[model samples]
Target: MDTYLMNERPSYTAYRERFLAAVQRHQGRVSHYEHPLKGRDGETLYTDVAEIGNPDATKWLIIISGTHGVEGYYGSMCQTLYLQGLDLHSLDADTGLLFIHLINPWGTSWLRRVNEDNVDLNRNFIDFTRPLQHNDEYDNIASVFNREAIEPEQRRINEQLWHDRAAEIGETSLRSQITAGQHQDPEGIFYAGQFATWSNQTLRTIFANLPKSCKQAICMDLHTGAGDFGHPMLMAITDHDYPGLEAAKKLFGPWLYTVHTAMGNTSDTGVSASVDGYTSQMLINAMHDKDFMQLVIECGTYSPSMLEHSLRFEHLHYLEGNDPGGHQEPGHSLKSALLEHFFPHDQQWREIAWVRTRQIFDQALVYLRDGQTHY
Candidate 1:
C-alpha cells in the first residue's frame, strides 16, 4: 500500500468493516446482497442495505454510494460518517433513512470504474426490450481503447487517432461521443453491457422492496469526478421534467442544477448528458407511482486532461491482464494515480466532499420530517 493511502484512504475491506460497524452501532436494520466475486483482499463482496428509523415510514431518504466503483470511496466514507453522527432517536416516526452502501462492490473492490464484466453500471440500467443506444463514432476510435499494451507505439497511435478525430469532429464532440456510453464494443471504454448488470438488477430489487405505503422519497446517488476540484455539485438528472425535479428546485433554489439528458443534448455540468439508462432515470421509472426525486452529488477532482490520461492508462493496464489487486510494479503506480484522481489524497477535498453531502442530507431530513415545501 502507498504510504499516503495508508494514512488517508481505506481499502475496500476496511471500508466495509467500518460501514457495517457503524450501521450496527446505529441499530440499523440490515440486509446484504452478496456478489459472486470476491474483493481484492479475497474478502466477500456485498451491497449492504441499512435502514435507520421506521422502515414502514411513509417518507424515506435514500443515499446510494458506489455507483462508479472506485468513486464509492467518497460515497462510502460520507455514508459511514453520517451514520456515526446521526441521532437515531431524533428522526420522526414517519420518516426513515435508507443507506445503500457500495452498490458496485466489484468495481470498488477491484479499484476499477467498471464492474467485474467491464460494464459501466450507470449505463446498464436501460430497458433491454428496446434497442440499445448506439455511438457510431465509437468505432472510429475503438482501436485506441482496444490496445493490449501501453507501449510507446500504442501511445503514439492512440494520440494520433485522438488528434485526427478531434480535428474532424472538434475536441468537445469527440469527448462527448467517447463517454456518452456505447454497446457496440464490449472492450471499449464506457461500454454499456448487452444485458443488465448484477448491480443494476440488485438496485431494481432494492427499489421493488420499498414499503408500499411509502409515498415520498428523495434518493441521492453519490459520485465523484467532473466539475471543479473539491467542489460538490448537487443535481437532478432525468430525461424529462417531473414533479420531484420541481420540488428539488424549490427546496435547494439556486443551489440545485437541473440536467435534462437526451439525444443531442449538451450539459455544462461535466457529466455526460447524451447517455441513457442512468441510475437516476431508473429510480424515476421504478417509483413512477410515488413522489420520488433522484439526485446526484458529483464532487469535482483533477483536470480533464489528467483524468483522460489516467483513465486511458488504467484501461490499458486492465487490458494487459495486470492484476489491480497486486501492489507491484506499474500496476501499483497506475492504480494509485487512478485512485487519486477519483478520490484525492488531499485532506481538504475529502472534508469538503463530506461536508457538502452532509448538508444535502440534513436538508432532505428537514424536508421529509417538517414537510417543508420550499427552501
Candidate 2:
C-alpha cells in the first residue's frame, strides 16, 4: 500500500482487498462478515477478521479499523503496514492476534462519519430499551448544521453561535455537548440512533465467535480527526473504570489518558466525555468475563476550527446528495478538505501517525504476550 490515499473519493473495495491480502500473508484464519448495504459505487463490503495464533492462547490483541467510515483510510493503511512488517514468529505461542478490518463499511464507502442510517457507530452501542441520551445544547444549535450550503455568511453565523455557546459554558465543555452524541436527530450530525446499528450488531456477533480461551485482551479502535496535529492520543474511554484499568496504566504508562463518561463531564483529550456509547465501552461489555483493556488511538489533523467547518460542510453535502431535485456533489476542495481533516496529505503527518501507531501496537503486543496484571 502507498503511504497515504487522500481525495474526496476512496475505493472501499480497494482498501478491503488490500487489507484482506495482508491478512492472507499472515496465514491467519480469516472470516468475512458481509455488510447488508452496498457501497455508493455498488461495491460489496465486509468486516473481515483474521485470527492468528492459537485460539487457546493466554492473550488476544485485537486491532480494529473504520469505526468512523472515512477514518478507515488511516486505520486500514496502518493495519496493512503492521502486517507487512510483522514477523509472526516474534509473537509468543501463547498470544493471538485478531485484525478486524473496517467495522463500518457503509460509512467508509460513503466517506461519512456515521453509518448507513446516519448513526455514529461509536454512539450506537447503547441498549435500545433504556432511556437514551439527549443533548439539548446540540438541539438548540442543530439548525446550524441544517443549512443548504456552507457559505461565507453561514460560516460567520455558525462561528458566532459557537463562540456564544463557548462563552456561556467554556469552550471545551460546549464542545463536549455538541459532539457528546445525541439520539434525537437522525438526519442531523452525530445521531446516536434509536436502536443497534448494523455495524453494532455485526461487531457484537464477531466478538462472540472469537476464541474464549484468552482471559486477557486489549482492543485498539483506530480513529482520526481529533487532538493536536499528527499527534495520536492513546485513550482509555469508557463510562467508568473497567477490569483492565490498572493493566492499561501499566501498559501505556503516562501515554494513557482515561476519561470517565457522563452527561456533564469535560476533557481536553479531544474525545467526548459528555456521552456514553463508545466502541471501547462496547468491547469491554462484550468481554466482561475477561481481563480486557479497551483503548482508542485517535490520530489528529487540522485545528478544531477547520474540523468544525468541514464537518458541517460534509453534513450539508450528504443531505444534498439525497435530494430528489438533486444537488451538486461538493467540489474537490470541499471533499479534500473533509478528507484532510481526518486523513491528511502531508508526508510528515502520515509518517508520524504510523510511527506512533506502531509504537503503541509494539507495546501492546508485549503487554498481551508477556505483560502481567495483578487484576
Candidate 3:
C-alpha cells in the first residue's frame, strides 16, 4: 500500500477509503470498529477505530484523530501512514495499540469544525447532573449575526465589540466563553449540544467495550489550527502535576512541550469543559487500575486572527445559506487554509513532519515496552 505524506491532501472520500483499506490490510493483527453516520453528501460516513496487539496487554497506547471535523484530514492521514509503516512483529508482548480515526465524520465530509448539528464535539462532553452551562458572553455578541448583510463598517464595529469584550472579561475569560462549550445556541460557534451527539454516543460504546485485559493507557488526540504555522505542539491535558505529565516529558524529551493546567504559556482553563463531553475523559474516568496519560498533538496552521476570521466566515456562511457556488464557498476556502496550515504542501515541511511524527511514535512505543511508569 502507498503511504501518504503531509504534502498529500486527499479528498474526503479517497482518504476515508485509504484509511479503511489500511486497517483491512492489518485485519489479522488488528480489530476494527466502524461508527457510521449519514453525511451531508447523502453517503454513509464512518469513523473507524482499530486496535492492534494482544487484548490482555498490560500497557496500551491509544491514538485518536479528528475531534474537530476538518482537522481529521491531517490527523487521520498521519495515523494511516503510521499504521501502514509500522512493524507489528517488533512490538512487545505486553503493549497494545488503539487507533481511533475520524471521530467526527460529518464535520470531516462537510469540511466543518462542528458536526451536522453544529455541535463542537470537543465541548459536548460535560457531566449532565450538574446542570448544563451556557456562554452568556456570546449573547452579547449575538448582534454580529442578526444582520441580513454584514457591511465593512458593521464588520469593523463587530471586531471592536469583540475586542472590547475581550478587554472587559479578559482574553482568557473571553476565550473560555468562546471555547468552554455551551448548549444554548445550536447555530453559534463552539456550540455544545444539550445532549449526547451521535459521535458522543458511539465513543461511549467504544469506551465501554474496551478490552478488559489492558492495564496502563496513554492517549494522543490529534488536532490543528492552534499555535505556530506548521509546528506540531504536544499539549498534555491532565493536571499539571499529574504523574503522566512528568512521564510524558521524560519520554518525549526536550522536543515535546508541556502545557500545564496553571503554569504553562498556553491556555488550559477552557480545555476541561471541552473534553468533559468527549470519550477520552470518560475512558480516563472509567479506568481504575490503569495509569492514564492523555496528550493533544495540536499542529499550528495559521495566525489566531486568521483562524478566527475563517471560522467566523464559516459560521456566517452556514447561518445565511449564502453560497456563490452550489456548496459553501467561504467554508471551502477556510478549510483549504486550515489544511495548508497544519499539513503544508511543501516537501520540506512534509519531511520534517514525517520525522517528528516517527520520533514521537517510536518514543511512545519504547515507553510502553519498558513498562516504565516514570516515562
Leading candidate by lDDT: 1
- 10 residues in a row with least lDDT, candidate 1: 1-10
Q: Kindly list the per-residue Cα lDDT of model 1 for residues 1-375, writing each as its tens digit.
A: 112322566688888888888899878899999999998878999999998888789999999999999999989899888888888888889999899999999999888899988899988889899987778888778877866336758666667777788889888788887788889988778998999889999999999997776999999999998899988999999999888898899899898988899877888888889888899999998888898888999999986662266777887778777575646878878888888889998887888888899999999989988878442
Q: Among all windows of ten consecutive residues in candidate 3, which has the lowest summed lDDT?
A: 261-270
- Displacement of residue 16 (Cα, Å) in model 3 is 1.9
Candidate topping TM-score: 1
Give the Å shift of residue 166 in candidate 1.
0.8
Model 3, runs deviating above 4 Å: 1-8, 28-37, 145-157, 167-173, 239-241, 253-256, 260-280, 306-308, 322-335, 341-343, 373-375
Q: Which stretches of candidate 2 lie over 4 Å from their true place?
A: 1-10, 147-163, 306-308, 322-332, 372-375
* Candidate 3 root-mean-square deviation in Å: 3.7
Better structure of 1 and 3 per TM-score: 1
lDDT for each candidate structure: 0.86, 0.79, 0.66
Ranking by lDDT: 1, 2, 3
The digit string of per-residue lDDT tens for model 3 on 58-115 reads 7888887778887787777777787788787887888887888888877877777788
User: What TM-score number comes out for model 3?
Assistant: 0.84
